[model samples]
Target: MTFNITTKNLDTFKSAFIAALLAYIFVYGFELTHFTLSIDEEPLDNFLQTLSAGRWGHALLRHYVLPEPYAPFFTTALSIIILSLSAATSSIYIGLNKLQSISFVIMLAALPQLAYQLEFSNQADTVSLSFLLSVVALFMIEKMSVIRASAFIMLTVVSLSVYQSIFLYAATLTCIRITTDAIKGQIIFRQALKKIFVFSLLITLSLIINSFLAKWTALYFDVTISNYLTSMIGWGKRDVYEVLKSVLIFMRDYLTFKSAYGINAFPFVLLSLITIIILSIKRKRGAPLIILMGFATLLSGFLLNFAIGSGMPPRAMTQIPLVFAGLFAAALVISRVRYIGLIISIIFLCIGSAASNKLFYSDFMAREADQNLSNQIITTIYNNIPNFDEKVTPVFFYGSYSPLNSWKIPSADVFGSSFFDWDGGNNRRMYMYLSTANLIKLKEPNEIQVKNSIVAAKDMPSWPNRNSIKIFDGVVVVKLSDKLSPYNR
Candidate 1:
């Protein structure tokens, strides 16, 4: 079987229209709100300020700003434009019909977790991922030319500079593209191996260039690049065993707690496997290589997690589903039962889109209620607390509070909204908001410099982590009784 590259013009207008419509519906219908201030916003805000102040060098190499360089506005918008163009080009290379491409774009635009990332996650990893995909799409679709190859290298460097985790995506896309090509007989096993070898070298080259670029850019800006890059290059306190353990845990979570994410990939991977098996039975020459490449693609995410040594939220994790979508499109184009493949792709996509919409809508309403309550309580506290800016307040929260209680109905995700949910993880921030003063966490008896304040919920007589309600040493202990506003309710 000889693989012939077929040229088909995708209805770019239809794809873009559907993508835009779905985006609008989700943004409006779900009321997905972006917060002005969040856990991750502080550094981004600082970076923006630095850029505005012409301290571009300091912004990228600022203290406590690690994990990636900060070039938000330019990188983000450029990435989005590149991604859109990449999608359009992919439709032609993969021989996707207008409907198929539209569905793919809709999934890209509407997946709830990805939507959450775009709305919240500070756009660093997400936009970097977009850049990585664009690199893959452009490289795969365009005929190899000196200029084109150089452009791919440049984009690849930019993608890596933005986020080191992009190596995971770069590897995943390369595997899928190579496997898809082999399955389509566009390349034999030898050619597929050569492509993989060349892609690996490109990634290595990109990593080296990005490091020099990061240091060079920092020097140009008169900033210092921290030793954090050492860890990013897979050298840190976490040993290989520890990293492997974390990766295993992450994999387990993906199959259970994060299974909805895996839904998009698992089915498509299975279909690809079955397709390869059938083709192998028919004496196909490159089926085994396709199988190997497909497995490599599946494991790429885990390897990335190990390298990062932490579990990332949906924003970064969405790369897996996107890779799965690309593989599905490639497989659909080449399958004998193309209609059946398309139907499965459509069904999986519809499920993912519906789940994403429902997840966000429920989270949106919860956030609205939480925000209102938070504002009211903070304002009330502000009104009552004296010397609000000059004192220290230690808060002990009573009563079990959960975001699930804020929803009008049972919320779509049991995990709760990332930004709105106030659990043990964020109790300190909420307390700071409530007190409007300096916060001091009391582990044991300690001397108070400023006025010591204590706050408890309405039903706080019996709660874990409770401090004594009795006033002592001129500490102003305030109990938010039932007589005050209904905060605990």
Candidate 2:
């Protein structure tokens, strides 16, 4: 097919418009409902605060991923960059033709699980993934028009400066890998290896540019030296076949249903993708596209899980489908399917999932109410102290501790949300470990003082450890330990 600029532009516009609708809906819904953003606002606030203070790298070094001089360099720099770009690109896409614009826009919205992250982190994650996707998108553009050299360079530079650094780099490499690898038998194996080596050099060059921009911040705290090292040792090697099966299960279970989340996200995306994959293989051999999309989705989860999480982190796990589906849509037309079978199937599944989730939202609201109650109880307890520190502190529980050295305080959430780096792993580990470790960390000094003060007041119950949780039906508020008197009683 020869080029048809007029029709192509229309496609771009439509795709961008769809992207904007979903992004805005997701963002506003959470804000209106007043659900906590999954990730804390404090980190970005802190980083921006650092920027305000005339220290560009310091904020990223100290708090971007893990306050470094501790954790590896600004590995998450790629994510942060992509997220901001996605947000910015949202507007740029609006004026574009329906297909081009909507394809980019929708892909931005779907990639990186920004909607889900927004429920907790607001728009920060969205910004990061946006940039990462832009890189992939631009790379495709480059294939058609090498004149886009400047644009590609600019996007790559921006990608290195933020948090999506690892996945962006890894995905790019995987794309190059799959492309060169596909022809190994067709081309001489030696020649294919030579092409791969050239791409490998290109990947390294990209990372070097990143190092120059971010000063190789990840190098500051070597992974070998960090505490997450203990975790890496525990999690074993990767097998590609196992990853693919897991990917299949992830699709069918989570994504098809409207309210599907994490482990439940796979069905809608995979079912749809399968249709495209068949088309790609038979007619277009868009295998490279599929491989890269799959790599981005799956590799993002794996890299984040190993580097930051325990294992099988749901939030991290969820991003695979979003990124894959968007890219898959770009290569095919779901609406063009003979009749409307494909589109209808996806819609039916989404609605079904939404129905099952109605009851969950009510409980979610109640969870909010319980959190409010627990806050009041904790505040009341705080007043008994003769001395008070205006600054807040994180309190962990159950004798667990943080990986980094933190200012000694009454409460320090070592592994909790703000501090958690787990890309995607068991949610419980993040909460439980941080809560318990912080309390254990605090109890060493404040236990006797806190206990004596409470006993003298004759209002509070005896604590089992220096920490305890003020529990509601849906939320757990970790506070002083009280085995003898449960907060509910």
Find the candidate with the highest lDDT and give its number: 1
lDDT of each: 0.49, 0.37
Q: Residue-wise lDDT of candidate 2 within 141-177, one digit each (tens)?
A: 3233444544454455444444333334334333323
**Candidate 2 segments whose C-alpha is farther than 4 A from its true place:** 1-11, 22-28, 32-39, 42-45, 48-112, 120-126, 129-133, 136-154, 169-201, 211-263, 277-312, 317-319, 327-371, 374-479, 482-489
Q: After superposition, how far is residue 413 of candidate 1 from its true place, in Å?
A: 9.9
* lDDT by residue for model 1 (222-331), tens: 65655543444433666877766776876776645445432433434546556655765475577677667766766775666666676555555646655556556555
Distance from true position, residue 387, model 2, in Å?
9.7
Q: What is residue 310's positional error in candidate 2, in angstroms?
A: 7.2
Model 1 lDDT, residue 133, Cα: 52
Query: Using alpha carbons, what is the TM-score of model 2?
Result: 0.51
Who wins the TM-score comparison?
A: 1
